[model samples]
Target: MTTLTGTERKNITPGLSVSIVLKKDQRSGKLTDGVVKDILTKAPNHTHGIKVRLQTGEIGRVKVIKTGIV
Candidate 1:
């Protein structure tokens, strides 16, 4: 199996809500369903991959593969 290094990921500024699907699952292959909760900007990469506290208090990273959106 080949792992994706990454594509030309466009810069996603914080606060802009976006959605993406999980592209790979070690056991299930891939997950087609996903939703955008919040955009993270504190990371060094300045990428939108972070989990924010929701009303339900759930925490998870944005499962957005650059290719899955476009």
Candidate 2:
């Protein structure tokens, strides 16, 4: 909503480019840029960001919604 880090699953629509952190990279807080292809989080909301799959086939919780990012 107001903060990109706390973006809800409902707001993460398909085709929207975003930066995310994979489960393996969670400890490192690495950010992977990709386009939202599928929403995996079924809950109404999440504090750690919504989990989604990118068009590149990478899955993770969103950290940043990208602008002109692949």
Candidate 3:
């Protein structure tokens, strides 16, 4: 179970479980876990993190990619 840093777009995909930092929670550096529903970031990589929309409709930049889980 190798986890990815979640800063690269190539590491993220639909259905993958990930921890994200929502815009509102950015100040607190909080993490919200959910399954990825869509890849929102167009770039290959980002300084902050790759933004994505979770299955539950929450949107944020990825902080950690939870490998081996869906």
Candidate 4:
């Protein structure tokens, strides 16, 4: 008999470091709030507020609370 193990999966913590995209307004260029579910790809150093997945299943980019930026 051969022994088998379950497949390994990626772990997503509650407070994991992630990036979100900022929604743009017609007039203002301010960033918006969003959720961070899965990172599409690594963000550049200059990049901020990338796309993210929300707990409500809505995926979009948002300004995430980080060390420097509040």
lDDT per residue (tens digit) for residues 1-70 in model 1? 2222211124443333333323234245343323334443355442334433222333434444333343
Model 3 residue runs over 4 Å out of place are none
Give the candidate order by descending TM-score. 3, 2, 4, 1
| Deviation in Å, model 1, residue 44 alpha carbon | 4.1
- In angstroms, give how far residue 65 of model 2 lies from its true place: 1.5
* TM-score, one value per model: 0.27, 0.82, 0.92, 0.35
Top model number, TM-score: 3
How well is each residue in 1-70 modelled by candidate 4, as lDDT tens digits?
2211111112222344433433445145454444345544344322333345555555544444433332
lDDT of each: 0.35, 0.82, 0.94, 0.38
Model 2: how far residue 15 lies from native, Å: 0.4
Off by over 4 Å in 1: 1-41, 44-48, 65-70
Clashing pairs in 3: none
Clashing pairs in 2: none
Worst window of 10 by summed lDDT in candidate 3? 61-70
Instruction: Name model 2 segments beyond 4 Å from true.
Output: 1-3, 67-70
Candidate 2 lDDT over residue span 31-64, tens digit each: 9988899999998788888999999899999998
Candidate 4's C-alpha lDDT? Answer: 0.38
* Residue 33 displacement in candidate 3 (angstroms): 0.3
